[model samples]
Target chain A: MAPVKNGRYLFNEIPSGYPIPGQTTVYDESETIDLDTVPLNGGALVKLLVVSIDPYLRGRMRRAEAKSYNEPFKIGEPLMNWGVGLVLRSDSSSVKAGDHVYGYFKFQQYEIVDATRVLVLENKEGLPWSAYVGVAGMPGQTAYHAWKEFAEAKKGDTVFVTTGAGVVGATVVQLAKADGLKVIASAGSDDKVEFMKSIGVDVPFNYKTTKTAEVLEKEGPINVYWDNVGGESFEAAIEYAAKGARFIECGMISGYNTSEVYQVKNLMKIVTKQLHIHGFIVTDLMPKYNPEFYSSFVGRIGRGEIAYKEHLLVGLERAGEGILDVQSGRNFGKCVIVVGEDKA
Target chain B: MAPVKNGRYLFNEIPSGYPIPGQTTVYDESETIDLDTVPLNGGALVKLLVVSIDPYLRGRMRRAEAKSYNEPFKIGEPLMNWGVGLVLRSDSSSVKAGDHVYGYFKFQQYEIVDATRVLVLENKEGLPWSAYVGVAGMPGQTAYHAWKEFAEAKKGDTVFVTTGAGVVGATVVQLAKADGLKVIASAGSDDKVEFMKSIGVDVPFNYKTTKTAEVLEKEGPINVYWDNVGGESFEAAIEYAAKGARFIECGMISGYNTSEVYQVKNLMKIVTKQLHIHGFIVTDLMPKYNPEFYSSFVGRIGRGEIAYKEHLLVGLERAGEGILDVQSGRNFGKCVIVVGEDKA
Candidate 1:
C-alpha cells in the first residue's frame, strides 16, 4: 500500500492567553504514515474521521507542571481530544479493521493508538460522524448526566443556560424545556440567538449586545442555571438566582483563554438565596451514567427527534483554526473538524 | 401591683456599615411594664431571660425597603431575636404561667408577644437558659442541619471551618471531629483559637494573626469547608479546595455589614475542581430536622459530651454592646445577653 499523506497539529508552544493557531499549534502536513506496515503492538492504526474542537481544549494549552482536570498538551507532540476514527489496522481483539471508534485521539489525520484509548462504536443512528464525538457522544453525555443529577428543574421552573447554541448548552436548554420549564438562554451572535429560539428557548438573547443581568432581572430569578460560559454571565446568574436555585457548572469557556478572569462580586447572594452550585467533570460521571445516556439520547438524536447542529471545518488542516474559533466564541453549534471521508 | 422597670434596645437608625452600639441601637430604660395589669390578648406576657445576639442581625439593620430573608429592624422599635423567656402570664392554651418558652422576642426586659411566636420548652436536660438561645438552640440547629445536609464529608476528610469559636462554627467543628474528620478551624483571637483546640479541633489558628490562605495552603486542600465568615477566608477556601470539595455556606457574616463586599476571583476553581458549594437557611430545614437535632444533640450537650462555650453579657443594658461585638467579630463563643435570672 502507498504511504498516505498525514496532516497534524503539533503543540509547539505554551500559550499565555488565547492560543495563536499558527504558532501555538503548528500544522505540519509534510508527514506520511505507512498504515500497511506501521507497528500496531496490540493497538490499532486509526484514520481520523471527525474531530470535535471544543472550548475545553484551551485548558490543555498550559505548562506541563500546571495541574488541571485535563493534562496539558505536551510540546513537540500532537494536541489531543475526543474524535471519531476508522480503524484501518488492529492487533487488538477489541477493535478490527473498518470499525468505527470514538475516544481520545491525537489531532492528526492518522495515528497508531492504544486499544484502551478508543472504544468501538456502531453508528447505527445514521447521524453525522461528528455526532459520535459531540452531541450523542461526550458533550451529549455531559449534558444528559449533569442535567439529570443537578439541574433538578421541575415543571414550570425557569432555567437559564449560557452558550445556548453550543452543543452542551443547547442540549440542556432543550432538556429543560422538555420538562415544561421556561428556558432563558443566551448566545454570542444574533444567528445563534435565532437558533436558540428555533429550539424552543422561551427567551433567547445575544449576550454580546444585551447585558445578561438586565435580561435575567426582567425574565429570570432562574430556578436552574446551566453554566457553560462562566464570567460576567455567571455573576449575573448568581445575582438573579431564585431561592434554592441550582447552578450546574459544566464549563467556564470565558475564563479559559484569558488572564483577566472576571471577579464574582455577588457570591453572598448564594447564602442569601440558599443556592446550590455544583461543578462536575463529565468523565467522572461516565462510568455511572454513560450507558443510561446512550440508551436515552442516541435513538432520539438519530431519528431527528432531538436536533444537533454541527459547524464543520472540512479538513484536519483546519483543526487549529476551528479550536481558535471555539475559544473566541466565533464558532456556532458543535464545532467539528472533518479529517477524512466517512464510508456510508 | 407595682409596674416593673423595663429596659430595651430600640432600632434608632439604619446603618451604612457596622451598626454603632449607641447610635444605631438606642437603649431605653425609662419605660415600665405593669406585669400584673398588662393585657395579654390571646398571647403571653413573658419576662425575657437570655437573648441571642448574632451577626445575622446586622443584615436586618438595612432600610425597610431592602429585601432579605429576615425582616428589617423597624426604626423606633425594639430589636428582635431568639430568646428564652418565662411566661409570667398567659391568655393562650399553649403556655401556662411558670413555663419556660423559647421563640423570637424583642430585646426588652419584658414584653407581650403572640402565642404563635413562641414554643414552650421544658429544660429536662438542665442546661443553662443561655443554651436555649445559644448552643442548644437555633445556632446549634443551624450548625447541625447545615452540616448533615451539605458537609457530605467522610472520616479522614480534611475540613476547614471559619469562626470556629462562635456557636454555630464550634458546633460544626465538634460534629466534624466526632465524625473522625480532620478539623482545621479559625478564630479571631488567640483565646478563641485555644477554645477551638479545646473543642477537639485538629489545627486551630487565629485568623487575625495569620493569613487564611497561607494556613490553608500549608495545612489543607480541604475536602469540606464550613463557611461562616465569607470574605478573604472564603476565597482561600475556594483556592485550596480539594477536588469535589463540599462547601456549606451557613453564613457570610463577613459581608453582612460592609458595603465593600469581597470580590471572589477564583470561582473558576468551582468548575476545575468539581466543587459543590451549597448555601442554606437553617430555618428552612427546621420543621424536618429540628426535632431530630434536639433528640440527637440535647442529651449529649447536657451531659457535657458535646461542649458548648457561651460569651455572656449579663444585662439587658449590654444588648447593644453585645450585638456590636457580634457584628464586629469581637465577641467569642455564643454571644448571649442574660436579661433576667432563670429560676432553678
Candidate 2:
C-alpha cells in the first residue's frame, strides 16, 4: 500500500473554562505513515481502531500546569489517551502483525509504538472490539478497584452512585447488585434515569428535577457513596451519609469544566458521621489490581454477566466532537471514536 | 458550713451564632444544697472546684439537633462538661470525703453524682488542682488520641497546628516536638505566636498578620496537619499539603460560632496529594487508647516533659465570660472557671 494517510487532533490553545471546538485543531491528513518505515527497535506499527474519550482529559488542557495527579497535555502536541489498535507491522516477538492491543497512545489514525508499551488483547472472547475501550477496559478496572479497595461494599449495603447511566457508574451499579448491595443512582435526564433502572439500579432519580438531599432523606442514609459527579452531589451525599459511611471519590465531572468550583459547605458531616472520603485515580491502582481485573473482570464481561453501553463516533476527525458530547452529557455511555474497522 | 450556698450556669436559649450573655443564665446562690441531703443511689456529694470551658460546647449550643457524635445540652438544665472537684461526702467506696477527683459533671458550684462516674486523681505531682481539668485531663487526652491513632507522626515530619497557643494546639505542638517532629503553628494574635514559640514550635505565625498558605509555602510542605481552627486555615493546609499527608481534624473553632461555614475550595488537593483527612472525637478513641493515654501521657505530664497553660476565671458565675473568651480567641490557653478552693 502507498503510505496510509494519517489524521490526528492537535491541542491548539488551553481553555479558560469549558473547552470549545476551536481549542482543538483537527487535521484530516496530518501526516502519512509508510508501512516500509517500521522502527528497528522492536516496535509495532498500528492502525488505531478506537480512542476512549474521558472527562479527566479536561484537567490536562489547562493553560498553566494544574497541580494534578497526571501531567498536563502540552500545547501544539497531539492529545494522547487510552486507545486500542491492530498491529499492521511488528519487529518485536511480543506482538506480531494483526495482533489487537490497547494502551496509552495519541488520538491519531495510525502510529508506531514500542511493543513493550502496549498490552496485547489475548482473549477478546468473541466480544465486540470496542469492548476493549469501555467495560472491559480502564473504566471497568476503575469501578472494580473502587469497590474492592475503597467502598468496602457488603451484602445488604446501600450505595448511591452519581452519573449512574455513565460508563463507570453503570458498571458499579451492576457490580453492587451482583454483590447483593442495593444501588441508588442519579442522572441528569429522564432517559438516563430509565437506563439506570434497566441496569438494576434499585432507585433512579433525575438530579436536575428532584433534589438529591430530599430523595436521599426519603430513601437513604447511604452506606456507600460512589461520587462520579461532585459539587452538589457530594454535599447531598454528606447530608445523607450513614455514620461511618465510605465516600469513594471517583471523579468530579461537575467541577471539571467550570471556572467556579462548587463550594461544599457540609464537609463537617465527614466528622459528624465519621465518614471516610477517599479519592483515587484508576491508573494509580492498575499495576497492583490489573491482573485480577483482566482475569476476573474480562471473564464476567465475556460471559455477559456484566453489560455496557457505548456511543461510537466514527473517524479520527470527529474525536473533538466525541469529547464535546461527553462533556455536555449528551453521550449515552462510554464515548469512543471508531478510527478504523476492527478486522479481528 | 452554712449549706455552702450553690451557684450554677444554665443553658437558657440556643444562640444563632455566638453565645451572648443571655444565652446562658448565671444564678448566684440559686439554691442552698444542704450537706445533709444525700442521693438514694450510692453516690458522692462533691463541691465543684473548677469547670473546664471548651470550644466543643458551641456545637452543643446549636438549636437544631445537629447529627453530632455527642449529645446536645438541654435547655433549662445546668450546662455540663469536664470539671475538677473536692468530695464533701461519699456514699460509695471509690473515694473518701476529702479526696480530689475529676470527670464529666454539671457547671455548678456543687452537685451529686454516682461515684463510678468520677475518677480520683491519685498523683497530683505538686501540679495545681486545675491541672486535672487542663493538661492532665480531657484536652490532653484529645491531643494524645489524635497523634497516636490518626497522625502517625514520624521524626522530622513537619506538623502544622492551627490555634497553636490554645489548649489542644499547644499540647499537640509539645507532643509532636517530643516525638521529634518539626512543628509549624498558627495563632490569631502576636502574643499567641510568642506563646507558641515558648512551647517549642519551630515556626509560629500570627494567622491575622500572615497568610497561612504563604507562610506554609515559605516554611513547609506540611506532612501532618492538626486542625483546631478550620475554614481558611484548613483551606491553607490543603494548599500546602505534602504528598501522602495526614490531616487530623480536631475542631473547627473558626466556624463554631458563625452562621456561615467557610467554603473550603481546595479539597480536591486531598485526592491529588493522596492526603488522609480524618476527624475524630477523642472520646471515641478513649476506650481503645485511654489506658495508654493515662499511663504514658500522665507520667509525661508529671515529669514536666509535657507542659500546659490555663486561663482561669475566678467564679462559677463567670462561666459565660469564660466561654465568650474562648469564642473570641481572647483566652490565651485552656479556659476554665475556678468555682471554689481545693481543700483536700
Candidate 3:
C-alpha cells in the first residue's frame, strides 16, 4: 500500500503546574509510516478510534524528574495513554486486520504497535464503541473496583461522593445507589448538581455555592467518602465522617493542576472517628477483578443497571483541550477525544 | 479521721491555643473533704501519688461546645487525669486504706472517688510507682496496641516513628526494634535524638534542625509510619511512604495546642503509593488488647527488655507547666507530675 501521514499530539515542554496550550503541540503530519512496514516478529498497525482524556494525564505533563506512578511524557514524543483503536493490519494470529481493539497506545491518528499489547474486542452487543473507552473502560473499572474492594459500601450506609458529575464519581454514585446506599454527591455547578440529582443521588449540592462542611453537617455523618476531588472537600469529609468510616481516595483533581495545596485541618477527627483512609489505583486490581469486571460489570451496563455519560471531542487535535476541559471540571462526564469514526 | 485540705489545679479558663498559666490555677487548701463524708454506699479517699500529664488533656481544655471523645474540664473544677494513688481510706471490699491503686482521678493532692473506678496495683515488681503511670501504664499500652493492631509491623520492615523520644513514641521505637524491624525515628532535640539512638533506633534525626523529609529520604522508603507528632512530620511521612505502606495515625500532638493547622501537601501520594492511613485512639483498643498488654508488655518491662524515661515535675501545682513542657517538647520521655510520695 501507500505511506500515511499520522497526526499526533506531542509533549513540547514540561509544565510548571497546569498544562497550557503551548505545552502540547499538534502536528498534523508529525510522521509518515508506510503501511507495508510490519513488525519483524509480529506487531500490529492500529488506527486510533477513541482516546481517553483523564485527570491523571496532567501529572504526565510535569518534568521527567518528578516521581509518579506513570512516567512523565518525554518532550518531543507523542503522548501515550489508554485508547480504543482498529487493527488496520496485523502480522500475528492474536488479532486480524479490521479487528476492534483497546489497550495502552500512543495519542495519534495512526500508529504501528506490538500486537500482543492490544486486546481484540470480541463482543460489542449493540453498545456504542465509545462505551469501551468510558463505561466499560478504565474509569468505570476504577469506580467498580474502588467501591467493591476499598469502599466497604453497605446497604443503608450514607456515602458522600466528590466531583459527583464526573466520570468516575458518577459511576460510583450510581453503583452505590444501586447497592442501596444513601448517596450525597457534590458538583461544581448548578447544572452538574442537577445531573447528579437526576441520577438518583439523594442529595446533590453545588460545591461552588455551598460550603462542603455545611452540606455535610446538614445531610451527613457520612459512612463512606468516595473522594474524587480532594483538598478542602476531603477535609470536610473528615470532619463529617461517621465512626469507623471508610474514605476511598480515588483521585485528587483539585490539587493536580495547582501548586497551592489545601491544608486539611480536621485530620485529627479521623482518629476520634476511627476513620480508615485508603488510596488505590484501578490497574492494580485488573489481574484479580478484570474477569468479574468483564462478566458482571459489563452485564450491568448491558442490562441498563449501570448508566454512563460521555463528553466527546472530535479529532486528535482537540486531545489537549479535552484534557484541560476534564481538569477544569468543564466536561460533564467521561471525557474522550473521538479521533475517527468506528468503521466496524 | 481528720478533714484533709487538698491542693488542686482547677481549670480556670478555656484556652484559645496553648494553655497559659492563668488558664490553670493552683488552689492550695482548695476544699476540705471530711473522711466522714464518704459515699452513701461505699467509696475510697485517695491521695494522689503521680498524675500522668498527656497530650489528650489539651483537647479537654477546649470549650464545652467542642465535640470530642473525652469531656471538657468544667471551669473552677479540679482537672482530672490518669494518676497512681494511695488509698487513704476505703469502705469497699475491693481494697484497704494502705493499698495503692491506679486509674482516672482528679488532679489534686487528695480525691474521694468510687472504689469500682480504680484498680489496685498487685505486682509492682521493683518498678517505680511512676512506672504504673508511664512504661507499664496507658502510654505503654498505647504504644503496644498501636504497633500490634495497627502498624502491621513485620521483620526487616523500615518503620519511621515521629516524636521518637516522647512517651508513646519511645515505646514504639523500642517495640519496633525488638520486633526486628529497622527503625527510623524523629525527635525535636539533639538530646532526644541521642536518646532515640541509645534505644536502638537505626537512624534518629532531630526534626527541628534537619527536615523530616530530608532525613526520611536519606534513611527511608518507610513501610510503616508511626505518627505521633503530626502536621509537618505527618506530611513528611506521606511524601516518603513506600507503596502499600501503613500509616498509624496515633496522634497529632504537634497540632493539638495550636490553632494553625499544617497544610499536608503530599497527601495525594497516599493514592499514588496505595497507602493505608488509619486513625485510632489507644483507649478504643483497651478492652481487646489490655489483657495482652498487661501480661506480655508489662513482663517485657519487668525484664528490662523495655527502657523508659520520665521528665517528672514535683507537686500538683506544676501540672500546667508540665503540660506546656510536654506540648513544647521541652520535657523528654513521659511527662509526669509527681503529686505526693508513694507511701505503699
Best by TM-score: 1
DockQ of 3: 0.74
DockQ of each: 0.81, 0.52, 0.74
Count: clashes, candidate 1: 0
- TM-score for chain A in each prediction: 0.97, 0.96, 0.96
Number of clashes in every candidate structure?
A: 0, 0, 0
Tens-place lDDT digits, model 1, residues A1-344: 88878988899998888888888888887889787898899999888898888888888888889888778889988988899999888999889989999988898988888988678887778877889888998889889999999988799999999999999988998889789999999998999998998999999999889999999999987999999888888889988888999999988888887788687778877888999999999899998898877776888898887776888999777888898898898888889999898651
CAPRI quality band, candidate 2 = medium
C-alpha lDDT of all candidate models, in order: 0.88, 0.83, 0.84
For residues B240-317, write the lDDT of model 3, one tens digit per residue: 888889999888888887778888778899889889988888788889998998877788888888888998899788
User: Tens digits of per-residue lDDT for model 2 on B1-344?
Assistant: 34657787888888877787655554446677777664526888898999899988988886555667778888888889998899988888998799888889898877888888788887647667777788788888888887888888889999999888887889999989988998999998998888888889999989888889998988889999998878888898988988778888888788777769788887666666767777777777888887887777888888988767789999888888888889989898799889988873
Interface RMSD, every prediction, one decimal place:
1.2, 1.7, 1.0
DockQ score, prediction 2: 0.52
Model 1, runs deviating above 4 Å: none
TM-score of 1: 0.98
Clashing pairs in model 3, backbone N/Cα/C closer than 3 A: none
Q: Could you give candidate 1's per-residue lDDT for residues B239-305 as a string of tens digits?
A: 9999999999988888887778677777778998999999998889999888887786888888888
